[model samples]
Every structure is written in C-alpha cells, then in structure tokens.
Target chain A: MRRRTPAESPSKLSDVARLAGVSLSTVSNVLNHPTRVAASTRTRVEAAISELGFTPNRNARALVVGTTDSIGLVVFDLKNSLFVDIARGAQRRARGRGYSLQVGSSDSDVEQQAEHLRFFDAAQVSGLILAPMHDAPESVDRLRSHGRPVVIVNHDPAEANVCRVLVDNEQAGFLAVRHLIECGARRLGIVAGRRDLQPVELRVEGAHRAARESAVPVEVVEYPVDGLEPEYGDRMGSRLAALDRDERPDAVLAVTDMLAMTIISRLTAQGIRVPDDIRVMGCDHNTAAWGGAIPLSSVSLRGEALGEHAVDLLLDEIDDPAGHVHETITIGPSLHIRESTVGRPTATPPA
Target chain B: MRRRTPAESPSKLSDVARLAGVSLSTVSNVLNHPTRVAASTRTRVEAAISELGFTPNRNARALVVGTTDSIGLVVFDLKNSLFVDIARGAQRRARGRGYSLQVGSSDSDVEQQAEHLRFFDAAQVSGLILAPMHDAPESVDRLRSHGRPVVIVNHDPAEANVCRVLVDNEQAGFLAVRHLIECGARRLGIVAGRRDLQPVELRVEGAHRAARESAVPVEVVEYPVDGLEPEYGDRMGSRLAALDRDERPDAVLAVTDMLAMTIISRLTAQGIRVPDDIRVMGCDHNTAAWGGAIPLSSVSLRGEALGEHAVDLLLDEIDDPAGHVHETITIGPSLHIRESTVGRPTATPPA
Candidate 1:
C-alpha cells in the first residue's frame, strides 16, 4: 500500500545532460532511442541517470512513445455520489497497476462528453473508461479511431466491437416489484424522470412482467417527473398525497435512492406511516437507501464493482490493443430490504 | 453552456511545416523564436499556420511556459460526499474560466497526497487546489516553490502566505451541542474518530464551551473510535446502548453524518426511540444527514461554497502569481434540524 514515488526534487534531463557532459537531446535520445546515441555517450547518460535517480517526465516520454502510464476516465457527474464511488474504485485499481487516473466529468451533455473525449485523445492517454452521455455511438467510434483502448461503463452499446460493464436493470426492476407483491401490495407505482431512457424502459418492462406473473392482478402505475433530482420526490409526494385514498398505489418505487428517500421524508412529514399506509423502495442503493429517515428498500447497482471491472477490461485492451477482442460484462443487481418496505415498529420510549 | 473545443482532428506543426514548404525546425523556430527563422520562411510559416489552423499541443506549449490550461485538485477522499460537493463547485468555477479540472483523491494519506502533487507538478498544471492530508506545511511550500499557485482547501495553514478556504469547525460544534441543550438535554456524548485532529478537537472544544454557557450542568462524555466510518458508528452505538439506563447520555453528537445515521439505525434496530429517549445529531451535513433513516440534525460545512472559494483563490493566483496575496476565507457553518433531534408522531392509518 506504500507507494513512494521519486524524490520531491525531480532530476531533469538537463541535470542528466550536465552530469554526462552532453547536450540535453543526447540524454533524451539515450532514454527514447538509445541505439541512435553513441555507445560511450549512452553509457555516460545511463550512469548519470542512475547517479541522479532521474525519471523522465511521463508526458514527455509519452510524446515519443504515443502512450503514458495514465488512464483516462470520463463520468457523467462527480456530484453524483454513485459516480464518485465508481471513480474511487477505478482509482484504486489503476493505482494497483502503477497507473494514475486522469478524470473528467461530461456533466451529462453530449457536447461536453465529446470535448472530454477530444482532450483525452489529444493527451494520448493509454486507455479510456467512459460513462457516455446521451448514448454517443459516434463518439465511441471517434475514440476507437484515435487508437486508445475503451471500456464503456453502465451503458450497453449492444455492439460486439465495444467493451462495457453493465448492470441488469430489468432484473433489478423485477426483484423490487416482486418483493412488493409478496409483501401483499397488489397496487404498485414506478416513478421515472426519463421514461425514454433504455434502463428506465427495461425496469418498467421487468415490473410489468412481474405483475403479469402474480396470482392477484396487480395494477401498475407510472409517474413521470420533469427531472431526476431530489426535489421531484417532494413533487411526487405532494401529488400522491393529494390523490384519493384508493387512487394512490400502496407501494412505490423510485429510480434512484435520492428521489426515494426524499419522497419518504416528505410523506413522513405529512404523518403517513411508511410500510404501513404505503411502502417505498428505490434503485441504486446509494447512501440514501440505507441511511435515510426511513431506510429505503432498494436494488443495488454495485457501482464500485462496476468501476473495478471496467478498469480491468480497459487494461486488458491497453496491453494488447491489436489483439484485444471486445467483450461485455453484465453484473446482476441485488435487493436490500429495509424498514421503508418492511414493517419495523418503533420501540417504547425508556420510562 | 455548450462550450466547443477545437476540431477532433487537431492540426499539427508538421502539417504547417509541410504546407509552408519549410523544415520542421524552421516552423518550430518561427513559433518559438521568430528571430531564428528567415523573414521569408517565417512569413510562409505564419501563412501556413493560418491556413492549417495549427495550434501547438498544450503539453508542448507547457514545456516552454510553466503552466497549462488545466487546474489540478487533490482531495482527501472522494467517497466522502463532502469532497465530491467541493469538486462539483470547483469544476463549475474552473469551467466558467475555460480551465479543465483534473481531480485526484489522496485517500487521506500524506504520501498519496504528495504523489498527486508530483503528478500535477510534472504535468505543469496552472494551479493547485488541495485539501491536505495530515496538515503538511512543507507540502504547500513545495507546491508554491514550483511556480504553480496553490490554494489549500478545508484546512487553514495558519501561514499568511498560503491561501486557504476553511470552515469554522468550532462554531459548528458549539451550535450542535447548544441546540441539544436548548432541547432540554444536559448530559451529552460526542463520538469522534480522533480527538487530536484539528477539526475534531475544535468541535469537541465547541461542545465544552457551549456546556459552560448552558444553565444546566452538561456532563460531556467523549467516545473515541478507530476511524470515521459507519462501522465505528455501529461500535459506538452498541457501546452506548450497553451502558446502564440511568448512566446513558440524554443526547449524542457524531462527528460526521454517516456515523450519526448509522448509530441511529443501530439504536432504532435495538428499539431505542430517537429524539424521544435520546436526541441525536451529526456534523458536515453531508448526503447522509438528509437521506438517513432518521433524517439527522447536522452542521453544514458548505462544501460546495468552500470548493468555489478555493478555485476563485487559485485562479486569482494563477492570473497574477506575483501580485496575489494569500488570505484565509472562513465560511461559518449552519445547523439543519430534522427528525433525528425533533420527534414527529405519525398520523393514524386510514380506517
């Protein structure tokens, strides 16, 4: 775990050149193209490099070799703790292999994503691990044409030529809805910010499939939101509270932990007993799912695991760029049951 | 919002040399030192540059100049959402100024922090925004000596020459304990990972100061943990719960929101009623504060604003390195009261 890089005062090529009594380019040639340098000059430069503990700047070395010991990652947003978790995992793995991670956030825009891609490409990074924004199939192609190894995270390009690590969104939806059904909730609701998203559509499909298999007919309703932020949870809570007693579903599932927890908070503030009057669940068991005012039952996306796997795949591609075969790794999500969807009575206050 | 970088096919200097019908070194000389190139050759190279839209690679340019259009940030940990919030704010400010943010987490290790510093130094970042690990005074000195502007975030270096953005930890601690005392809880317990750490010591000192001001006798018990993680919260929760009923503190304050929420979850699982049997609070008002099962009362560190201010300071230094005066910017913390410290009775279920 202890990685000691070279001394604080890095020995430069100029210092090596001074010690070897040669031009700076002679020292550079000794490192980059030793055969081009005179044997005596190369020997003198090598002795000086050892004496001074000189390490060439990776970027300068990369300029000659076309690659650096750095991995580039572009996520949708750093503010989202889920992406942070992924980045943390990626950093750990990248460091274990002696490579540093260079990160950029696209902020969920295709143009920004393309800009980031261009930067990484121009930087000549050894490899790229991207969580694409807006399904940029063309951008991926552009990245490939630049000749860097690529591993797309979370999204499935559904193409054989790209490597990706993905979660089974459809299975996650089925487990969540089926759990509610088994808990005696015949009416269920799903809240999604973007109904058109592929993951959202898959989750909805999974929920519908679960409803179809149930012995008792389950009525599934979908609630749409203008955005995917926590405030929408408050909006949904207010709208649901305003509904007729029988019109509101007894159980609700939110696409993310942030939205689910806020909805629970808003509903609890209105004096509704969670898992009693209405059960609530969420996906992406982020910090909110396990830590909220009412612990939310949720489907886990295993973001850290996704990130680690993506790095492994990207490194494999980097090692043998020409020999690399694109492959997809799909990880299944798990359900975490908590007080929000299960009845847990409060203890009597200490007398 | 749509900031476009130059074309993906970046024009190279070789292309300019080919167009100008000049040697590569002639074009290089024309760009780096126009006096070295013949007047006719320089004119041809300038015309070729205009026609080819060739801009020198940033890394190559950074070698001549001591900086690049990239801002480097080093944080303690990314999993701690507070840092993520700070990064989000820094990214926003840096983006507005046409600088790209390059982030690295030190994982709370001084060595890792130094490694990141070296990477940024070798990469020749325009400026550095650092949340130092273990309060290394020399690290900041080393960074500044390298000619890049350094803005220390979170921890105040106490040295006037070192720019910093800090949170008033002592004030935050006093607010949390005073709030508990105002709620009629005299006996208090504070769970901290390390009492020796500056932030932790300040918070504990704040609690003591608040106790001195309160009308009632406040017997504050300090509980130390191995680390500031959720597992430590569980450890503290079980130990507190094991204490004799009459000896237990009336209220508890955890060092972080994550720890506070976990303790609440553990205590609730053991049938203890929060804010009824014992009021609970936390600090750093991170995501766990709002999303936890009990909706913890916490002191907000305003991480985003801290990050924004850090970037502003760094950018100012980057813009006018010699003219810049290092000053500390302290932002006061605010308290957020929620259900963890305030009881809310649920409404009766519909008949």
Candidate 2:
C-alpha cells in the first residue's frame, strides 16, 4: 500500500465517481440510496471507495441530517467496573445499530457533568445516556427541549416526563440482608456511604425493611462512611474488630463490592475469619468480586442490562420524537452467593 | 428559568447580535476573536449568549476550522480499570487545555478498533490517542498521512516515525521476578498468557534476564495460558497444586495483576499459603490488588502517566504539526511489594 502524503487531501465523492467511471449522482445514490443504483454499478462504486479510501465526512452528513450518528454516554465515575461494563454493553448495542458510542467520565463532579452534557449538546449527538451523580432535572429538560433524546441510566428521577432505566436498588439491598439472615446471622451491620445519595438511601431503606420483617430478633446497626474508598472500609473493619465478640455484628453487608473486599481483607489480616467469625457480603457483584481471596457474595446490579435498555429507550425516542412517550424501566437484582457469606463447599475448583 | 420548546432552534449568532444590539461581525468577533471586540460589546454578547442558551455548533465550527475542540481516545478494553485510569488522566489534561476528550473502547477486537479509527477520522477531531491491541503501522501511517496527530499509548510500534508512550513491560517483568528472587526464591514459575502478545513476550524476556543474572543457580519454568481470564488462572493454580512438592516452583510471577489475584484466590482455597509456602507476584499493579484477601505485590504500569504523556505529545503535534518531532517515550515500571510476595510485618492495620 502506498502511503499518501500529508499534503494530499482525503478522497472525495468526486474522486470515487471518477475512479468508478460514474456520474456524481450515481455515486451519491450508491452511497445513500443504494437500492436505486444497479448492482454492478454499486459494486463498482464500493470497489472504488475501498481503493481510494474514501470516508464520508460524518460532520458534513450530520449537518445535513440535523444529528450525528453518535450516542453520548456520561458516566459519574469510570473507576468502578460497573460503569465500564455499562459502557461496553452500550458500545456493543450502539455499534450493532450502526451508531458510534462516545463516553465521558464526569469523575463525580457536578461541574464536569454539566460540561460533558454541554459538549455532547454542542456536538449535536442523536441521543444521550447519563448515569447521573445527582438528579439534575434541569439539565435533562434543557437537552430534551433541544430535541435530543436523553435516557437516564442507573438512576430514577423524580420527574415523570423523562425516560430512565433503573435497577431495583431497594430489592438489591433487601436480597443482601435477607440472604445474610438466612445464613444464620442474627446481628447485622450495614456499611453505607452518604445517605443523601438516592441509591444508598434506597438500599438502606430496604435493609431496614428486611430487619423489620425478619422472624428472628435481629439487631440492625448502621456503619456510615464519608465515602466508599478502601480506607473507609478499613476503618469500619477496625471499628468492628475492636468490638467485643458479643457486641460485633454476626454479618456485615457493604454497599459496594470494593468496600466489602477491603473490609474482608482487613478482618482476615487482623486474625478474624470471614464466614466463621462474621459473614461478609457486598452489592454490585462487580468483576473484581469473583477473583477475591474469598469469592464475594453480592447482589447483581446488571450494569450491562441497564446500559442496553437505556440505549434502546434513547434510540426509540430518537426515531420518533413527537410520538415517543416517556417511560421508566426498572430492572430487578439477584443474589450471587459465594464463599464470603457461605463457607466454600468441598467440591470442584471454581471455573 | 423558562422551558424552551422543541420547536425553538438553538440560538444563532444573528439572534445573539440582535439581542445584544451589536452587528453580526461584532458577535462573530466576540466568539472567534474576543480581543477584537470592545469590553462593553463583548459583555453584551456574552450575556445574550447566556440568556439565549447559545451553544456554538461544534460540527459547523469543525467544518470551518478543519478540526473540532475535541480529542479522541481509543482504548483496547474498557473492562480494565487501567485503561479507564488512562482515559481519566487524558480527559483531565484535555479539559485543562480547553478541549473535551471522547473515549471509545475497541473491546480488543481488530475490526472494532478500525471502526473507531474511522469514526474519529470522520469526526475530524483535533488529535487521537490510541492504546492499540496490535501494532498496525499502516493504520497509524494512514491516519498520520491525513495530517491528524496520532499518539499511540501503552504500545510500542516497530516504526520509529510515529509518536508513542509506552510502559516498559520488560522492566515490569524484571521487577516482579527480581522482587520474588530477593524474597528467597530459587525456582520461579512465570504464569503468562499467549506469547504472541508483545507485552507478554517482552515480560518473559525480562524474566529470563532476571533469572540469568541471579548469582545462585535458579530454575525457571513457564506456565502458558490461553487467555487472562480467571478460569485460566484457576486452571493454572490447580495444575501447580497437583505438581509434586519438589517440582513446584518456589515463587510465581503472573503476567497481570488480575491473573495473579485469581491464582492466589485459587491457591488459598486449596490450602496453599501465599508467601509462606510459595511467594507470588504480578506485573501491572492494578487497583483490585489492594483490596484482595492477600494484598498483591506487583509492578506499576503507570497508566495515568502514560495517558498524560500521550496527550501532551498529541497536543504538541496538533498545535504545531510541522515543527513537532515524533518520539517514543518509555516509562519505567517500579515494584510494589506487599503480603503476596513477603509476609506482612505485625505493626499496624492497613489504612
């Protein structure tokens, strides 16, 4: 293959037409209205396109079409594999539907989130999928008013007019606590982060409900942290380890898998057995949970499903703006029991 | 704030000029060349822009300026938090330079990577930063031939004409094995993925160098796996467990932190104590290694630094393509010793 010089411009439609010995309109028909062109002519045009490496300018097409064949996904944080999984899922689905997915991480900053939203708006993307840090109804409304479809992922906004995809976080919490109770835990400690966050609040709510409904007299205690970092988990673990045997909770459920993994590591390092002393579990069933020393028991958040569904909803609205009716889709969570909660059964090695 | 209807188009320069009681040229100058406009006129134009919610169309601007105020970053996989960290670093740096960074994950598919490269080309972004799965010099050359600044990250291509930022995989391998040897290991087992991969091949080369350089005669064994999944790690662990006590290596070095974590988990499940019986270490000190049941000792790939340097090189080229010189910058890896390689000192709990 001969390398083209920097001074040489990219092959244009005219270049393709000239190479294929076809008129300009014929080349255009071959690209856009392919059915209108004869098979032989279309093949010739395609061969010419491949030979010349002619790539139609998406920006130029977007100007004509009023929207780009691109979807923007704004995630709160990319550090968590959950968001990464979501992006992977969204990207696959977007590609399958002949669109490119571009992602931006806001890093949990509200200002950064606004900047990303604005950038996508300026880009005039066909749609957006947002995993918001906070319920920014105004931002959603502003984007929607500009005729861009928006789908909120992993969040349920209070506004009824917006489309959203949410995991049943309450159900996730309920499952985690209920599983702990079933594992013979009478006292429970819920390691939670900021209560103001909707997911955290909802999970805590469901945990309390589980405690209230338990047949056994369970003492439910809450261990709050400023954030969900490993250091915070280490602190919680130290505080729990310091308690008298009778005062310590029989089991602990951390809000996230990372936190749970850290707490379990801390406990084990301090001479405390995992399931033997205090059972441990986490939420989000993250990829890291599977490879931990004690395989983590967690509630599955289904990040991939959330991402797929959000894109589905956004595309549906983009295809028919006026006729589209806003809807909120809720996905249910499930439990993944592992050695952290239940001692490893003597059997085949994990696959 | 009044809600604008979908029928309303985004505010244009004409609208801003009209509202600000300024000429169209003044409005254009205020946006394109702010210093060309008087302070009072600029303030009026800015206020009009704020009030009318004017977002300059990036696509239109790109057509005029030949590039958008955006940079494209294509990573091999989003599933790896290392890539995510790189994206985060690139984004922060790009944002500081008044540009938005858009990321696309190729998911380790060659076709997907080509598609992303094409997408960015059509988008006509200011520059591109890619962490390629395979060294495709032709693709890089083609992109560069179009006058687009390309900075390859985490991979060193054989071609010296392109700019690249790379972590020294050979050094990473040497660091892991040297640490294991320092901790009193006469025999070493390298758990690696496919040898076709450049990083794997380079790491193995460094591991051999370390073994050869050892003062005492050291035996080295290679345990090759099909892939880096946890299942592969588990299989490797089981195979090593079944080996005769004298046949098994005194220490093991996995190619990746993820693989090492899984191996440790599997070994511990089968009653093999890390460090006490066989020391274990890994290359690429990933974030998950910190919270594992046994804290993993590995080599730091410095993903963030790689990303930051890639962007710096890209932006420098984009700013002055003719004046820029292509350079391959190598980043050396450092060892991070933890409990997996050496028994923890009994002082204080992990923070």
DockQ (C-alpha based) per candidate is: 0.24, 0.14
Which candidate has the top score in DockQ? 1
The runs of at least 3 residues in candidate 2 whose Cα sits more than 4 Å from the true structure, single-residue gaps closed, are A1-68, A234-246, A261-277, A286-296, A338-351, B1-68, B145-147, B234-242, B261-280, B286-296, B338-351
**Candidate 1 clashing pairs, residues 3+ apart or interchain:** A291-B292, A291-B293, A292-B291, A292-B292, A292-B293, A293-B292, A293-B293, A293-B294
Give TM-scores for every candidate, taking all chains together and pairing residue i with residue i: 0.77, 0.74
* Per-model TM-score of chain B: 0.77, 0.78
lDDT of 2 by residue, B261-319 (tens): 88887887777778787888878767654445666888888787677767767766775
Candidate 1: regions farther than 4 A off? A1-68, A266-272, A288-292, A345-351, B1-68, B288-292, B345-351
| Candidate 2 residue lDDT tens string, A88-169 | 8788767655577888888878867877787678767789999997898989989988888898988788878878888999
Give candidate 1's error at residue A251 in angstroms: 1.6
Q: How does the DockQ of candidate 2 come out?
A: 0.14
Interface RMSD of 2: 5.6
